[model samples]
Target chain A: MEAEAARPDRRAERAAARRRRDRRGFAIAAASTVLVIGGLTALILTSSGWPAVRETFFNATVFKESFPDVAKAFWLDIRVFLIVEVAVLALGLLVALIRTSRAAAMFPLRLLAILYADIFRGIPTILLVYLIGFGIPALANSDAEGSSTLSWLPTEPVVLGAIALTLSYGAYVSEVYRAGLRSVHPGQRDAALAIGLTERQAMRHVVIPQAVRNVGPPLLNDFISLQKDVALIAIIGVTGEAFQVAQIMASTDFNYTPLLCAAVLYMAVTIPLARMLDRWDRGRVR
Target chain B: MSGTPVIAIEGVTKAFGDRGVLRGIDLEIAEHEAVAVIGASGSGKSTLLRCVDLLIEIDDGDILLDGEVITDPAADPVAVRRRLGFVFQAYNLFPHLNVIDNVTLGITRAHGLGREDAREAARATLARFGLEGREEESPSNLSGGQQQRVAIARAFATRPRAMLLDEVTSALDPELVGEVLRAVRDLKQEGVTMLIATHEMGFAREVADKVGFLHEGRLVEVGPPEQVLEDPRDPETQRFLRRLLEAGRA
Candidate 1:
């Protein structure tokens, strides 16, 4: 009788095993959810400042009233981010290709690229914004006695901010591209050359394609970061973007709801991108 | 055995920094003949093949193709390599390209064939090598034997003047070795001039018109297969064959 029960009917046995696994998973999830909710309730009840914190940060009416202005300013933030992201990727790739050039004549170009990456990457982003925003215009106006020869240079606050962001972000992204380029196996290059492809053709057809593929996930991380850093433009007094508008609103109303609104908007865009990139990462491994 | 030489390596020498790999090596391949070089690892057999293919720059002397000096500084290595087909021990097929794409890359790029014509030629070549239905599959999906054959097909599709195979079967499973060697045998029967560096002693002896034994960056013995394999004159060649014999490889 015992032997008969043990005799394998494979489908039925597999079904029973799956049911047991599902039940175990459900039990663990239920216990964990209860613990989290219990801990959160205890913390809220025991804290002395909970009411004050709630009144200042989570006022629903303030959230409702501040939503429109914050939402409007967010479009400007999005626009700047889109433009800067494209500029950063293109400039970064150009610098990386030059840095990795194999020709003897490209030594000077390679050195320039190395210096650019090191210098821009060392300085903080806010300092770069301040310097580019105030320094360039100030230099153009420094010669007060004569006609400013550099009048043709851009003095707009938004343009200067975009330039600052691009320069800073470009340096970091170029390193990412360089790492990807180096990760390609030397054997791939050898095979390409052995088949009569010129060095340029080999890089164009074989090396760059593999390099770009390898760097896709890390590129997304840089992109999400660039999206967040768009807020730093508020420092340069670009009053059209969300963070600047939120700062003004908070100072006038003495409520932080506008800042919270801006935070929510940023998370709204970034969380979806992060999740999408996670999916891409999983698919690549499979 | 006597026609205009397809490839001739004249007193070629190469070194990596301080260590000399190929010291004053000379070789010649006549029309429709197979020359095999056999030696232990690191004996410069592969370097000799690489020098002929122009993958490595020779330190001294020159290589000639069809009475033209191809190793001159002015000679375009790209043009010279286009006339030669080379396969490596590891079967370095591009991972991103499918079988047909890999086979057709040289055809389209170097041979200047249009996309449609290159694809047609690639398909016929793949079919000839018993890989007709596998054209669309990535190289990573194939067995080691199949991948090696694809590498051969990629080389043959361009109608190169001569083929250089560097221990093409060294990385394959034992059962897979016969299939690759069979393809080589068919190429020989079809009158392709080939220079092969290999470790398979029995196959080399059976298929090669001439055999050369390399020892320490020099071609120590080179003659007819029977003379070189059956009665090697040099002490290094003798000891090398004796070792292979003791290992049950000869």
Candidate 2:
């Protein structure tokens, strides 16, 4: 009698399990269908018989002819990368210190840092670079004949690109630092206060070191993003670097191969750093 | 409450929003005296200890330390906090700092001690706490008991006149609690006045020179261990004591 009673219940349980499995299968099928459709759409759009794309992207002539100029462009990109990286780190740290300070005197400075970050981050980087490169010079040298602050700035495209990248990237980097500061345990600050360390002393000795360690992975990811964003400077007619070399080749040969090459170069720089960040994040979890 | 009370609380009340957490507490601890505050959760014992350390600002009244009004409206809170050390329940040692650096940080940074002198002081404190060979190890690498001891050492390294211990041993496991309590007991013997908010009835009964029972933000009873723990005068005190004993059994 007990076995007979349990049989229907077992049948119901089996039915529920079967239904769940069916639903899951349906969901997987729908997702795969969407993915396949999207992939096909992308392939069709990018591989449409555009002569520029076929000749410049696939043919070897454009690459060979532009190799030297592209090499110079890549070197310029490196210079921009180094300069922006260093500037962002230094300025970000400074902004973090200001934001964390308790002194009433620093309140205005903190407000200014916030304003700088918000304004720059909200606006397009190209606009800021254009303003700095073109607008600032125009404003500064309106009185002088063929002389401006742009003259004082390095004439080389590499130097111009570095300055533009630093100005835009530094603002964004400050927010990363602020997030790091917020991640530090409040108890750490209390511990420092309990020990009689002044606010500044505690921040320097206790808080910032731990915050930096905690935010390491995100900061590295940001660096990778910054690497890709460096290409934006090429829009300002700064050529002979990675992105610019591609642009020069694309314009001359009317093909997309150099652009593809630039994409590959970007992936090369970012992919390893991305993997390292993933490993770091996994280690933190463990 | 003789020999110039090291700490004097006169109608000290603390509140958050509309709720009164510490309702007009008046207490005193004589120099070198160990006072253990026993209470259930939300009794404001921790708040009172923080008030003494000036870690939490009081809403009303005064906290006098060394016979001076440390919590006076005009007094420098940072300066007052300098003379009072605090050990937290969670052992809030700087994770980035090694044992020695953790102990010597305040001495070197706040007290302006020479690095060598600060290190020597740190070494001596670590040795006192039986952490002689573990100076270079990060606090995270140490056991809970060792980390608490290091925290105690760091607190005592500055030679504060009084230390606020907020449920210091409450977070440790049963096996680990004794080691941390032992460190506190050692500090007591060495004349470090402490205001400890604790849940360990046995330790409170044994080591505390005076014990105060706090129930619902009020000090229901205050007396020596025997009077407060064994022979309570108040009904609330008896009930609290009973609950603690029953909980311990369970």
Candidate 3:
């Protein structure tokens, strides 16, 4: 009975079993991944059309020629994505707060917030980019001197495109924020109010901080989509971005390898971002 | 206990949809006195507390805090709440905040105390509740009893006019309930006016100046704890006590 306290666990056998279990888990994961992903990769690589597909999609000379320019242009995508993401975050939070506010004075603003979310979220992102990019300039040029719209209304495709991206994503991100705000138990908000915090104070300091914490995963998930959607700008004739440059290179040589190069560049940012989000999520759970 | 009432609930009627929760309930707590409301789970105990805090609106009737009709539609709920502290059963300390922040938030933000002064006051209150050096630890790190104590401290730190304890010890493990009850007893000894909703009949008998029993959304009985717990006139009150005693909870 005295020694039972000292030797509470079968430590040696348990440790060995734990190690064996971990190794078995890892082996199964690796085997299943190899069987599924690797099998698909190998099947495609060995197909009868593999030679032609390789020539068009995986030409090393084409990659070497296109990657440097595409990589350089990818910088534009990174910069715009960062700016748009931050802008969307701020705007989305504002809309969410406005929508969630209960003040009678904020009634009209609340309606506007709802309408803004609905309109922006309803339109396709590419269509929005096209409309804003082409429509604004077209309206401006139609002016007698093109002065007012030229002066204030952005004719630049990139600027217009960025604005469209911000609006479109802001709507979606605001809904995410709203869901986060709602996900927080009503008791927390009640507790905040019980302590004498005003409605605004409760939301800003207590509710918003907690809500933002709740939505971190979904927020990051949206940003990932936004990062890829930055390529939508290229469709509106924005030059010096990855996809457009890749498209130009591919057209010149009729080799699709440049497109693959662009895909790799997009993954370079997205994969690391996804990984960071995952790491943060894990750290939070621990 | 003084003659002046810190909180007075009069003819407070509340209904959710068509089902009534509090049907013309009336109770009062004098300054430095504790009144415990004991009843089964759906007996409107929490609803009474929430109505007094102005957390939920009553369809009819009024509540008075320090002789002012707070349930008047014109009254500011936030200002009314500012003077009273309501502790929830679940110990709703802000998970994102450390223990000290949970206490200091109301003091600094709502009470408008200076940050340093709030911290000093909060430290003293936390220490009084047996949580002195654990100020900066997150609420999640504390055990159930400790967390409830922090919730109590967070409410008490602001020096509220009246403290509302909503089954403060109900959420804790049976073994951990004593420490939280001890904290409430300390408040009672400190002469803090309190309106407590609780399941622990023993705690009520020990700390409360009076105990009220609720049955079917009605205040069926109210008197000194000894009178209410030992000999009750209402059938509902007697039946409730008999059930508790049968379950060995009394």
Candidate 4:
């Protein structure tokens, strides 16, 4: 009789535990569902005018007319992105190396990197673009008579856009690389030292490879952000490939159709890359 | 003992954040001596070994390795560390590199061995530690015993004058402990001057030439393994031995 009585109490405790777990799981599921629904509603309301959206997005004539100019602009964007990203990656790595190194000389470089990251991350990218595009050019024009070097270097929209993006993203990516460096286990460094590798050799052979692998997803995400950010270059009125096409179509029809079309083009490029990143992240998690 | 002492620590003091871990540790390890440091956790055995290798900077003492004062502020720590190998309580195998790469990394970089030669040397060392044909396997994929062996192989591959084993077998399963100990015993037979911090009294009794007991950051006792283990003169040493024996028996 005592055993029977205790059995029911034990069963009750187990049921309560199960109920608690179920409640927690349900809460998580409900929260995720609400978030998804909210996002979907926002997307639907923003894109509610289907006919206008369709005309802007799927109109074959508009796409065909803009194709050549859009292709050129797209290529230009790619060039800017590639150059900026490569430069940022190289500089960020160098800064990360300096940040991690014990050498007293690297202390100044480390501080500079920290300051750069703080300043660039704090400022608006638009402000940086304006500063480089308009402010620098205006300042240079004033001094053009005295400084041939300053005058000779083109402050064209493309050049300014590239420089702005590079500086801004370079600062951000340096932090990413720094995080990657920090993620490397101190034990691994000690192990390398024990086996007779110098600090630099240990970093190059053991630490950096692991750090790069660890930061792969974040690095990819940064690349995608940079890709979309190329649109910011449109503000300068340089009218390269994408902008020229958008301007011609918008002017012809006096509609925002061309801008929407360009947005879709961007989605087309970035969506696939984003999906690849998602898959890579999932693989890493598993 | 034909050559000079492989490692000599005199008046070595190490502290972490105002807490002195090694308070003026003075010891000499002859060439090819296998000295075991047995102590409770945080008793400064590990710190003493690290100081000898110049991994941890000494606060106020000098460490002479191969007749050179490694603890000298002017000495290059990297150069000093190149002559000694260390294994940690948690095997610090490079997870990114497979066993072969982990072992060959130092040899290739520090000694300037060509890739083929380094790989060859690494292969031989790995084979000795029963890691043959496992060169391509990542340390993460290997079992704990295998990983520890790979770490040991990595250290031994460098051909250092001395090896410091900081509780190498502590993290292994009881069944797995033998394989690592066997590897250490093999290293001992090869005349590697070793300072091993271990909790395994049986292994220390069986294999160590000398055993030292550390208590509260002090080397409280040092003598032959039988004398230290069986006939401890210090009360703290006896109590520690008793507890360890009881735990092992349990």
Candidate 5:
């Protein structure tokens, strides 16, 4: 309160105290991490099945051997992931736009978008994979009179799996997009419209950019989920993605080491994405 | 007030659900005239301005821009809005855009000017408003008064035929209100056709050629500022002014 207390050196003294407090906080965090890791290692080593468990799941030799095969198979998952993720983003945005359309002419499309989200979101992803993967092929082959109408559909298990994932995730991501769209203050769009931009032009330049920026974290979360769900294609029983290869190796060698490798691969991809999204969210807040 | 009417509102009615905000309002603004509508909060002054801009569609009657029925269902609201400028009470500058970009958006996107040319024009407009080196700064970073000035700059940059300012200074701090009112005063001096809604009685009296008093969604009285402010005939208008005087807001 006094002018004497507001001296320039007092500011530096307070800043130094703040730095010391931060250093203490960092020390506590490091100590806790070390303690937790130490406790986990001690528990794992002292377990009765430690040697056999290590051999079956954490075997260095088996890990090395399975790494190449699992890594190679993961590329297929990555391909499906990349393709489906892009398709999902586009489909989600389209569906979200349709659902939010205020025009009477778009009623049917809006209803269809609503229906797609409801049905696809309700159906389990694995079941969708089975139905599309096996059902479409069966339908195409069925010599029943008018069933050949489905012949143009891709019967390949991987492609069907991708389509199924696209539909399922598209439903989910559309909601994310919708929430983002709605999260933007109506005033922003009003300002754009007041300046004479058409609804679509305003949405494209102003609303969508802000909405997408707002939903960046959730979109990244969905992408990470999508990356992991690429393994779900293995449920179709044919495509040799990382999970399927891991399953095959586990069955053949009676060891789960290959599964561990696949798990590690997934974490490698997802953890970085999660971290990047967190950074982006924090940067925006800052 | 002289020349032909630039904006003509005829029996324009607007309602939100069952609550009518504007009750068959009729008003007209001549070219190069400055008309200020003053009233208590929720007196439909804002609704009137928004209706003219087509931001809020009127439920009944017609609005004309330069003698053409802009409220006719066939007219393109975007095209009509392109020819008119508006400043909101909240100074709704795009938070994602810097000051210059916010000012230039209308020219580049709506008026079909090239982006580079719009930017050049926006910079000059910002400079005219004493924001020369602040073009690249986001509006959120500016003070409330500066932000409102930028909003005014954005409205001015389009070279619109007429301008609508809806309670532009009502959201500002007491100290900041002067700068915004000064900008509006500057616009008035340039002979811009303006229909302004304000709670600032002194500014309205100084800047307005004509003043209208709105009460319960109806224009109770309208005339020259001297007549409306000094010699209001309606009891509601008298009571409104008396309340303002008691609050020391008049």
Candidate 6:
């Protein structure tokens, strides 16, 4: 007779052992994390400059005092960022389309687009900002001969800074868009055309939609960089943005806490976006 | 057989640089006839189909759709393609569009069917291909067989004069291949004229009214399925069939 009720099941016993092993693993991981992190904390706390560093860089008073002004200036940053982002997206797609088109009439424009992407993307973004912020106004206002050319150009540092950012980011984003366009299999174009869509309609409806989807993660990545690099405008003396305002407050009292406040503000927007990008990537991959 | 051929190719030639792909090929598909071109991987079967659809411009000669020469400089390729249905080997369904949109794009945009009518037409076509209730799903979310079925539905929705199938079953899994081929067989039941470039010898024997053997950019043999597959007169055709038998595909 098989007295199964009296016997211990092998599967049950194995599952119990697995549960024990998992618990032990988790405990070990927790212990190691505590030991390493606590050791580092103790060492940093014992450093000789800890007291002074805490007062200037991590002071609660300065952060509170500068938070309002930094937040106010961040609005300007937000406005510039939104405007520049829209301009960059449009400009990038235009350049990529011109470069990819086969029209003989587009030859000159295609050459100009190629050079624009190459030159703008090659230079550091801050250098472009500095040159445009100062050079354009100087050239437009007068010459050594006192004969001005293109005098209608805006002299505002903010406008010039926005333009510089758009040009630089547009170059990088255009390359991203071009790669997306090329990544589509040639068979796709054939199938689209075979369905009776005109070449223009094919690009607009079938080709571009898929191309944009293929490069979404990289495109968002470029926008994130564009967000953080908004601070570079401060180098051209656009002092209304958060980073510049924070720097001014920090310099007045020799307290670095206002800079920390600005960093936090930037992170507030960028970190959520970065997390969303990660999730979007996971969805696409799955 | 009594009227103009649905598609006629006369002395068609195409080349990519010094390498010629389709060299002086002539073929015809009469109304309601299914013509299967059997060939090795790069024997210009696909090139032939693409040339007929005007996806790839011919280097010489002319192709006629319903007795109208389409290769003339004045002929509009877009309008010509709108009158033909071409299915690719890779099932090139637009991944961004759902099944319904993929089917309706041609009907609405090219045929000028109203959106509501186009969608109803797409639904009916998809249902015929056993793809009903899959209208909202992305092509990427589907199996390879289901995707190819959707592609066929998309092409058939516009009700073109002839269907060009370039190895539609070649990219499918072995088990899934039967479903897509069954869909094609159903199209035959509707009396749709077809030109298929395929490697399935059994399918060619079952469905094609005539079989053409292509070898290195030329049609080496053309006859009834029995004469070509069973008793090919050309030595090249015999050798090709023997190779297939050795590989257990025949």
* Leading candidate by TM-score: 6
How far out, in Å, is residue A106 in model 3? 3.6
Residues A35-80, model 3: lDDT tens digits:
9999999999899999999999999998998889999999999999
Residue ranges of candidate 5 with Cα displaced over 4 Å: A1-37, A142-147
**Which interface RMSD does candidate 6 score?**
0.7
Q: Write the per-residue lDDT of candidate 5 for residues A71-171, one digit (tens) a residue.
A: 99999989999999999999999999999889999999999999999999999998998888888888778464755776887888889999999999999
Q: Deviation in angstroms for A175 in model 5? A: 0.3
Clashing pairs in 6: none
Candidate 1 lDDT tens digits, B1-250: 5677999889998999988989888888898889999999999998899888888889999999987899998889999989999988999998889999999888999889999999999999888889999999999999998999999998888988998999999999999999999888888899898999999999899889989899888999999999999999999999999999999989
Label model 5 with its docking quality class: medium
Assess the local accuracy of residue B240 in candidate 1 as a C-alpha lDDT between 0 and 100: 94
True contacts kept of each: 0.67, 0.87, 0.84, 0.84, 0.78, 0.87
Across residues B108-188, which tens digit of lDDT does each residue of candidate 4 receive?
Answer: 888789999999999999999999999998888888999999989888887888889999988998899999999999999
TM-score of 5: 0.92
DockQ of 5: 0.79
Better of 1 and 4 by TM-score: 1
DockQ of each candidate relative to the true complex:
0.72, 0.74, 0.75, 0.73, 0.79, 0.84
lDDT string, candidate 2, B1-250, tens digits = 5588998889988999998999988888888889999988889988899888888899998988888988877777778878988999999999888999999988988888999999999999999999999999988889999999999999999899999999998788889988998999998898888888998888888778899998777888989998899999999988888987777721
Assess the local accuracy of residue A200 in candidate 3 as a C-alpha lDDT between 0 and 100.
84
Mind giving the per-residue lDDT tens digits that candidate 6 earns over B34-120? 999998999999999998888988999999999999999788899999999999999999888999999999898888999999999
Q: What TM-score would every model get versus the actual structure?
A: 0.92, 0.85, 0.92, 0.88, 0.92, 0.94
Worst 10-residue stretch by lDDT in candidate 2 chain B?
B241-250
Q: What is the TM-score of each candidate's chain B when compared with the real chain B?
A: 0.98, 0.97, 0.98, 0.96, 0.98, 0.99
What DockQ was computed for model 4?
0.73
Q: Per-residue lDDT for B73 in model 2?
A: 79
Worst 10 residues of 3 chain A by lDDT: A142-151
Measured by TM-score, how close is model 4 to the native structure? 0.88
Error of 4 at A79 (Å): 2.1
Off by over 4 Å in 1: A1-33, A142-146
Select the stronger candidate by DockQ from 1 and 5.
5
